[model samples]
Target: MATDPVTDWATDFDHTDDRWAADPFPIWDDLRSACPVARTERYGGAWLPTTHADVTAIANDSEHFTSRSVIVSGHRPPVELAPAGIAPPISADPPFHAASRRMLLPVFSPQRIAELEPSTRAYCNELLDGVRGRDVVDAAVDYAQHIPVRVIARMLGLPDEDGDRFRGFVEGVIEAVADPREERIETFLGLLHYLSPYIEARQADPQDDVISLLLASDIDGEPLDPLMVVRTIGLLLIAGIDTTWSAIGASIWHLAATPADRRRLVDEPALIPTAIEELLRAYAPVTMARLVKQDVTLAGCPMEAEDWVLLPFPAANRDPAFFDRADEVLLDRSPNRHAAFGLGMHRCAGSHLARMELRVALEEWLRAFPDFSLADGDAVRWSGGQVRGPRTPPVRVAP
Candidate 1:
C-alpha cells in the first residue's frame, strides 16, 4: 500500500509490490468495498475501477473514455518498430475501430473459428502426449502457455518452428510494464522484423492466412490500407497469445489445487463447458485501460480529458453485486455475465478462437491427469499488471 504523496489516494494501490502481485484480489476486495473507483499514482498516474458495474460502464462509455492507449502506463511506441504507434481496432476509437474490426471480422468469425476447433483439439492432445508419462508437469509453462501461441501462429501463417519465439515476443510485449524499456522495445522490433517478410510475401502472393484476408478487406469503397494490415496483425498477435493463455493457466491452477473441482470435472465431463465458464468468472485475468476523452463523473469520481483509467475486468468478474458467491469458484455457476473477454463494442474479437483453445486445453489436461495437485514443496506464483496468472504452477500427477 504505497501512498501517492501527490494524490494520497492510491496510498494502498502499489501494483508493483510483491504482496499485491502475489494476491491482488484482497486489495481489490478492499477497494471495491471502500472506493469502487480508486486512483493509483503508479504507471504515470491513473485511476482503477473495481466493481463490475463501474468497469462495465467505463468499457461501454467509450465516447467519454477513449481507447487510444489501452495501457495505464500509456502507449509509447518505439520509433524503431513500425511507422504507426499502436494498432487498430485495439488502439483506435469508434468509427475507425468499427472500420478496422470489419476488416478483421472474417478472420475471427464464428464459422472460421468452428473450422479450426478440430485442429486445436488435436494440437492440445499432441502437447499433452509429450508429458503424459512424467510425474510432474508445469500446467502453466508446459501446457497453458503452449496452446494459445500455436493457435495464434497458425492464424498468422507463421512457420511451425517460429511458435516458441512467437510466445516470447508476446510475453515481452504484454509484460512490458515491469520489464526493461530496451528489452520490451527490442521485442517490438523483433516482431516487426519477423512480420516484415511475411507482410511482404502476403502482398506479393496472397494466401489463406489472416494477412491475405486483411489485404482483401475493403473499407468504404477501396481496399483497406496496407499499413493498417501490419498494425492489426501486431495487435492480434499480442491479444491472441496472452489473454487466453492467462485464462487457461488460471483455470488449470484452480483445478490443480482443488480436488473436489477436479474430481467433478473428471467424473462428469459433460459439465466442462459450464465449469470452464465458472472458472473464467472466478479467475478472470485481464485489466485494460482507456484514456479519458471528456470530463465525466463516474460513480462520483472525477475524470478529466487525457487521463487514463484502468478497466480491470477480472475485478469486475468478482464484483459481489453481479455474481453470486463472487469470491468463490462455482464449477457450474450459471447466468454469469463475466467480462473475462471484455464487453460492448471493443469486446474480444478473438473470443471464439480463444474459447475453442481453452476448451480443448482443459479437456486434454484432465484426460492426462484426472487427479492432480500442486507440487508439495513449491507454491503457485502469480504475475500482476494487465494480466494475472500463475507463471510457475507445478502440478503433480499421481501414477
Candidate 2:
C-alpha cells in the first residue's frame, strides 16, 4: 500500500506524538509557505490545508469543500457522536446548512445575548468573589471552566447541578487520547443516553430554552428528527462549553502573562471588545474539518474527492499575509476578520453569546481585581488538539 504523505501528516497531527499541540503554528507556518496543500499518510490519504488563503477559500466555499463526516480522514466518527461529522447534501452542503443555522441563530442573537449579560456578569463576579482574599486562584478550574458550563447549561434548561458533571464528561471525551477508543465511544454514548430522557421531556413539554426550542424546530416544515436534535444539542454542549471555557482561560493567561495588555484594558475599559477579538484570534478554540466533495485546485495545489482538509484557524489568524505583527496582542486590531467563529454557513451559531460571555467576564474581573498576576511557581499551559485550552491557569490577586 503506497501511503499518502498527507494522511501521514494528519495521523501525526491527530496523535500530536511530535508535541505539535504545544506550538502547532510553526508547523502551519512551514506548511503555508512550503506545502500549502500536502498529503498525509495518517488520515487514509487525506489532504491537509495549512495556509491562510487556502483555508479561508475552502471554509467559504462550502459548495466545493463539503463538510460531511470527517473530511480530513475518511473515518466516520462514532455514531454516538456523529452529528458534527455527518456531512451534506444535508449535513455537508449549504441551503440545508443555512436553514439549520437560521433555526438556531435567534437563540444566540445580539438582543437575546444582551438579556444574558446580567447573569453572565453575576457569574463572573460570583466566581471571583470566592478568591477575593486569597493570594492565588486557579482561574481555569475555578473561574473560566465554570462560567461557560453554568451559563450554557442554563441556556439549555439543564439544572446547575449538572454543570460540573457535564463538564467532566466533556473533558473525558476530549482528553481520552491515552484511553482506548472504546472508552471514548462509551463516554459519548453515556452522554447521549443521559440526555435522552431530557430530550423526551423537552419534546413532551417544550419551553423557552434551547433544547426545548430545538426539539420543536422544523426544517422546511418538517419537525427536526430526534437524532438530529440530539446531535445538535451535543454540538452546542461541546462548542458552548469547551471552546468558551478554553477561550476564557487563554484570555486570562494572556492577560496575566502580559501585564501591559492587562493595564491597557484596565485603563480603557472600552477596549474590552477589541481585546476579546484579538484574544480569540490569538487563541482559536476550535479546529475545523471539511471534506473534498470534488476535485478542486486551491493555492496552486490540487485535491481529489474524499481528501480531508484540516483548517487550522489559529494558524491562519496568525498568518503574516493577513495580520501585521501576528504574534503580538494588538488590542485595537480594527477590521479584524479573523475566522474565530469560523466562516460561511457552518460558522458557530453561539458566537455572539460567547462574545458576550467573554466581554462580561473581562469586565467583571478587571473591575473586581484590577491588579492580578500569575501565582508564584504556578504556570499555565494548554492541552488537546481539536479542542485546545489551558491545563490550569493560576492567578495571584494583588489586593
Candidate 3:
C-alpha cells in the first residue's frame, strides 16, 4: 500500500502560522481522510488528530491519551494549568477525574448559570446600548470581548475595574508569539502578581464566587491547595473569556456574511438556542491537544509515548460523516453532538455558563441590530492555531 502524499504534507505542522488562523478546516479535512492519526513535524514532532472519531476516542480514553502536559508546545505552561496537567490517575483515569470534577460541579450547574442570565443579558444590553446610536462597531472590541470578561469577573466576585487589566494580561500572554521572550515573561509575572492578592483575599475572607468555593473545597476531607485554587481560577478565567469571546466574534461574522441565515435567526428568535449549537459547531474557537501516555495504535497508526496530539475541534465538527452540509449554518441542527465543549470527563466545566452567555448575547444583539454587516475594508484576524478565532471583526449596524 502506498502512503498518501496529502497526509505526508499535513505531517509538516507549524503551530505559529498566521495562515492557520484564517482557515484550518480545509487542511484538516484533507488530513482526516488521508491520515486520521498522523505525526507532525511541529511541536518537537507531535501527532495530530483530525477526525471527529479520533478526537472523541482520545478525549474519552484519557488513560491512553493524557492531559497531564500543557496542550500546546513552545510556551511556558500557565500557572493555572499545572494542577490540570497533573490531574492524576483520576485525571488520566476515570472515577478520579469524575470525583475531582465533581468538586466544582455545583458552581457551574445549569441553575447556577441560569441565575446569572439577567446579569449577563444586562451586561450585553449595556454594551450594546452604548453603540446603539453608532453606525458601526467592532463586535470583537465592543461586545464579544467585553461580555465574557465582565461575566467572568462578576462570577469571580472580582471588581469590574479589573476587566481591562485582566484583558491586557491575557492579550499580552496570548500575543507572546509576536513579542520578545523577555516581555512575555514580564507579562506572565505581572499576571501572577496581580492574581496573588486575590488568592490571598479569597483565603482570608471567602465569598460566593467560584474562587471562594474552590478555596474552601475539600477532597476526601482535605482542603484544596491554595496554589491549586489560584491555578484553577486562572484557567477558568482565561478559558471562559478568551475562547468564548472569539466564538462570539466568529458567530457574528458568520451571521453578517450570510444574510438569509441572519434573517432566519432574527425572525425566529426561539432558534437562538439551536443557533448557539450550530455556531459552536461551525466556529469552534478553541483547538485542544493531549499527550500519548503510552505507545498506542489509532486508525492503524502507531503513536509513541510522550507524543503530542493536536485535536482540531473545529475540523472535527465539520466532518461530513457526522454532519450533513457541515459547512452550511443550519440554525436548528438537532442531535448536534459537536465537540465544541469537548467530550468525556475532562469536558469544559463552564460549558453551561458559556452557553447561557452566548444565548443571551445573541438574542439581545439580533433584536437590536438585525441588519448588521461587516465594516468596509476591515478584515478578520486570528491567532494561535492551537487556540483560535477572529482577532478583529469590524461590524456595521443599521437601524
Candidate 4:
C-alpha cells in the first residue's frame, strides 16, 4: 500500500517515509526544538518523543505505556497479549518481563560473547574473502548483511544456506511496517510456518543452541509454551540480524564517507571499540514502539490510551542536553551514555554479541580494504520504518 508523502513533519510524520529513511537527523533536530513530542494521526495515531529526557522517561515508565505491541502498524496486537507480548522479554511487561529476560541473560553474558568472538572474526574474514578481487562491492550486502545472519543461524542451529530467506523475513517484519495490517500479519504467519519445522526438530533433538535453550527454559517453574518458543526464536532471528546489520552497514557507510575517521581508525587499531560506540551513537538502527497503557500527558503531549509511542533512540542519542557534541562523532568520546542498545528494562539482551560483530566487522574490513570510498553517494539506499540503516552502501576499493 502507498502512503501519502508527509506534507508537514510535525503534524504528519511517517517513520517509513523516504525522507525519514534517507536522513532523519534534521527532522529530529527540528522536532526537538519546535515540538519535542510530535504527534501524528498515522498508524492509528502515534507519538514521537525526540528528546533524551522524554524518551527515557517513557521507556522506564512501563505502567503508563505497555510494551505489548512494540511495533506500530495499522493493526495492533490483541490487548490480551500484554504482560507477555508477541515476543517475550522485549515485548513482555513488568513482572513477566523480568523473569522472561533473566532466563536468557546467561547465554548473552560477556564471557559467552567472548567465547564466540574468534568464530565471529573468522566469519568476518570469510565474508571479506568473497569480494577480495572486486573493484566495487556493496559493503552492506557483500559484508555487513551476512555476518549477523550467519551468526544468528549458527546460534539457533539453523542452516547457513537459509541466509537469503532470513533476510526476506527480516525485511518483511522490520521494513514493511507501514504495510496493511493484513499483510503484516501474513508476514508473521509465514515466519511462524517457516520456523515450525525447526522448532519441532529442536524439541525432538535438543542441541547446544538458543532454540533448545528456550525450549528448556521456564518462567516461574512453568515451562514456556511451544508458541512462546516460536515467538522468541522469531524475535532472535528478526531483531538479532536486522539491527546489527544496519549498525554495521551504517558504520561502514560513515567510514567510507569520512576519510579522516577512516584513516584514523586504520592507523589506530586500538580505537575501534571507542569508535564503534561513537558510530552506534551517530547511526543507531533500532527504534522501539510502545502502546499506551492508559491516558497520560508526557512532555506536554496529551497521549491517549492505546496510542503508539515511538522510542527513537537514535534521536535521543543525538539530544544535545544528554551528551556533549551530540551531533558530531568523536571516536575517543568517553563516558558516552548513548541509548544505542535502548534504555531501561527492555534494553537489548544481545548487545554484547552486537558489539563484538560490529567491532570485528570493522577491524577485518579495514585490515583488508584500508582505502575505500563510496562508489556513488547517490546510489546508497537506507531502509525505512523503525529500523534505519543503509540498505545499499556500495563502496569502491583499490584495485
Candidate 5:
C-alpha cells in the first residue's frame, strides 16, 4: 500500500549529524518503521530508500534507475557524475556496465584470488608484526587502513611504498563534504595524473598489472577511450581502498568488544567464514546512490526522473523483515544473503579480494593477539558520508 511520505521533517534527515552517524541504527530503524521512503531535501534533493526490499528492487531496475550519480550529497539536477558524462564501469549502466565488468572479471576471479592469497596472508602477518610490541595501537590506522591500499597497489604494479599517498586520495573521494570543492577537484586531478603514465605505458608495453589488463581489454569490438581507461583506473585505485578497510575495522571493533565471538572464532576456526559474513552484514560500510531515470513507482513511492535515491545497504543488512534477530551478529547464521557488498549489477567487483583480505586479516590478527579489547577511556571516532568507518579505534592489545 502506498503512503504519502512524511514531508515536513522527513526532508531534514541530517546525514551529517555527528552523533547519528556514529550509531545510525536507531534512527534508520525508526524511519523504516514510520517513513521508509523518506525524502531529504538536502544534497540537492534526494530520497533515502532505507528498506531491504525497496533498495534491492531499485538496484535491480536499471531501466528506471540510473547509476549515473551514485552519491546522495554530490548529485545535482539533470543527474551528473564526475568528469561529466564519464563514469567508471562500476557506476555505468548496461550494456557498457556489463562490458566493463567483463574486463574486470578475470582479474578478481576466484582462481586469481587463490593465486594472490599467499602474498595477502604474508602481508597481513607483516602488518600485525609491525604493531606487535605496541602497548596500544589504532586498529583503524595502524592496521585495517593499510592492508587494502597495499594489496591494490601490488595488483596495479604501483610501488607499495606509495600506498600512503593512495590512502590520502581515497579518503578524499569517499568523504566529499570533508574537503572543500576545489580540494576534491585537486585530488581527482592528482589521481588522474598519478595514473596517466601507467595507462600510457600499459598501452605501449603490456604487463601483468591491472592497468595493462584494462588497456588490452576492448569495448564493443574497440578499445576503450583513453578517458575511459583513465577513469576506470582512477575508480579502481580509489574505490579499492577504504571499503575493505571499513569492514575490517568494524569486524575487529566487534571482536574487541565481544569476548564470546572472539574466543569462538579463535577456538573454532571453521566458523571464520560465517563469522566474516555476519560481520559484513552487521557492519556493511558503503552506501551507493542512483539517479531515477524515469517516472517509476518503487515500494509504493512515486519516483520521478532526475530524483535521486540513496541506497543504504548497511540499513538493508539490518532489516528485521529479511533476517531473524536482525540486529544480532550471529556468526553461524545460515542462508545469510546480505547486501553488504550490494545487489544486482553494481555489486562490488572487488568482493573476492575484500573477502580474502578480511579472512586473512582476521586469521592473522587473532593469531597474533589471542585476546584484545578497546583501549580504556578511548572512544571510537567514525566518519560519515559516502563510505563510513572508524577512523580511530584504539585497542589494548594483550600478550
Candidate 6:
C-alpha cells in the first residue's frame, strides 16, 4: 500500500497513509486548529472530524448518519443492511441496535469480566514465561496480540489453534482497509465460510460460549437468522482482537520508551488501572466510520448522502477543547472523559472486557519484567487504517 504523501492534511487526508498510521496525533492536532472537519476524496469521498464536539454530534445523530457499513472502504454495504448493519449493534442503528446489543451485554458485564481476570493474568504470565531468559522480545507478537485472540476464542468456543486464522481475518478486515474492493469483499466472504460450520455445530449442541448464546437467543420470539449469527461471530473475532492488542502493544511501547512511567507502574501497581485510562486516551486504537444518510452541513462543510464520515474517537480523545493537557498522558488524570470506547449508541459493548485485558496485561508485564525499553526505536511498526498501534514493538526485557 504505497500511498502518496499527504500534501495537505485538511484537503486530502488518507487514514491508510503511512504518516497517519505511524503517528496521527500531530496530524489531528494540526487539523483541529486549521480544519476541524477535514475533507478527503479518498475512500470514495470521506470526512474526518477532529474536534470532540463534531465527532460526538455525528456519533449521536442516527438520523443524519447511518451505521450501515462502519468500515470505510472503497465500496459500502447495501442500504438494506441498515437498522441491523453488517455487525449488529456496532454497525446497527436505532430500533435494531438495542436488542442486538442486549444479547451480549450480560457476558461482558463488570462481574463477568472480573471473573476472567485470573485466567487473563495467567495467560499474560504464560506469555512472559516463554521469553523469560531472552534479552529482547516483540511484545506485540509475543504477548499483546495473543491475549485477546485467546480470550475471544474461548468465549466463542473456537479452537485456540485457530488463532493464526483469526489474525489473518483481522488483518484482512482492518489493516487492509485500502486494498482493492474486490479483494476486501472476498476476505469477508472467506470469514463467513470459515465460521458457518462452527455456528452449525453450536446450533446442534449448544454450549456456554457466545456462539451458542447467540444461537439460543431470539428477537421478539423469533430465532436469529443464521447469517446474522455468523456475522456477529465474525464481529467478535475481528473487533475483539485488533483493538485490544493495539492498545496493549501501544501501552507497553509507551512504558518501554518512557522509563518514568514504567517505574511508576512497577512500584505502585495500583496506578496501572488509572494509567490504562490515560494510555487509552493517548493511544486509542479504534476509529469508527459512518455513512452519511442524507445531505447535511457539519461545521460549515456540506456532506452529501452516502459519503463516509470517519468518527475518529482517538482524535476526539486528544482534542484540546475536550480536555486540559489533552496531548500529555497523565497517569492520575481525574475525570478522564475520553471517547476512546466511542460515544452515544455505538459505544463498544466489549469495553469492560477490553479494560480487563489491558489492565491485566500491563500489571502482569510489570510484575514479570520490572524494567524494559525499546530495543530499537526505529523498529516499531504500526498497522495502517482505522485501527492504529504498534505491530512490531520490540523491547529489551531486563534481567
Model 3 TM-score, all chains together: 0.90
TM per model? Answer: 0.92, 0.89, 0.90, 0.99, 0.93, 0.99
Residues 98-158, candidate 4, lDDT per residue (tens digit)? 9999988998999999999999999999989989999999998899999999899998888
Positional deviation of residue 63's Cα in model 4 after best superposition, in angstroms:
0.9
| Candidate 2 vs. true structure, TM-score | 0.89
Would you give me the overall lDDT of model 1? 0.78
Give lDDT tens digits, candidate 2, residues 46-157. 5567667777888888656766653232354543332234522224355566667777878988999999999889879988889788888887888888888888888888
Better of 1 and 6 by lDDT: 6
Model 6 alpha-carbon drift over 4 Å, by segment: none
Q: What is the Cα-based lDDT of residue 147 in candidate 5?
A: 88
Please, what are the lDDT tens digits per residue for candidate 3 over residues 59-139?
777657767643455443433442355333123344445556887788889988889999889889999899988888888
Tens digits of per-residue lDDT, candidate 5, 73-145, equal 4435245452223457767877667778888988999889888889988988888888888888888899998
Provide C-alpha RMSD values for all models, in order: 3.3, 3.9, 4.5, 0.8, 4.1, 0.9
Q: lDDT tens digits, residues 128-199, model 1? A: 888888888988788888788888888888777776787777667765565556766677778888788888
- Quick one: how many clashes does candidate 3 have? 2
Model 6: lDDT equals: 0.92
List, residue by residue over 40-80, the lDDT tens digit for candidate 6: 89888999999999999999999999997888888888999
